[model samples]
Target: MAPSSNTRPILLIVDGDPEVLRALAFMAETRGYGVIGCATAAGALADLDGSVSCLVLDQNLPDVPGVRLLKQIRDAGIRTPALLMATSPSAALQIQAAAAAAPIVEKPLLDESLFQQIENLLAGA
Candidate 1:
């Protein structure tokens, strides 16, 4: 079931670009999700926990790549579903993310794709 207003899903969004982070957070908020925006892998890691319903991670994070960050999170035992964001991901990155079961949401996010993906992930989760 979709979460009620009082139980809105919390999203952990980690992106290097401040503008993109703000824009993504604004978009998710408009869609009824709470957003915790972070500019680096460390910040994201610090905030990650069971309370975060989902993760929107930029593939090119400055401190650590998004996929590696996901690995660390998994190693820490947080099973939150993650959506990997990339402008143009290489094949190797694609394979790695697939192995980790993270779907890549390409940049220039258009047509509410990010929200759609979030809904799908939430539904499956």
Candidate 2:
């Protein structure tokens, strides 16, 4: 059965890697969040619907920088909470993401930190 709209956290995940996308989707679904996986910035932008409660983005997409995408969405007045992930993110990138009000989750998502952080962000939102 489909989860009730108000009960599930709708997550929009944007990553270039198909493997990562699949893993995230499975994780999100297993955790009972409605998952929307997109392989590109354009695809993600197109799918940003009202139901989405969070934006999970890869820092370096082939088509556009994850920060850039977040900025664009914010500029468009979309206030969806965003979690940006990168592998060893540069200092400048970290500052930029914070300036944009998006939290940066360093890549290799080894522990439960990612999920914990997501929970905090969404709960606060």
Q: Which candidate is the best by lDDT?
A: 1
- Model 1 scores a C-alpha lDDT of 0.89
Runs in model 1 with CA error above 4 Å?
1-3
Q: Please list the residue runs of candidate 2 whose C-alpha ends up more than 4 Å from where it truly belongs after superposition.
A: 1-6
Candidate 2 local lDDT, 54-78, one digit each (tens): 8999987989999999989999999
> Which residue pairs show backbone clashes in model 2?
none
lDDT of 1 by residue, 60-109 (tens): 99999999998888788878888899889999999988878788988888
User: Which candidate gets the maximum TM-score versus the true structure?
Assistant: 1
TM-score (all chains, Cα) for each model: 0.93, 0.93
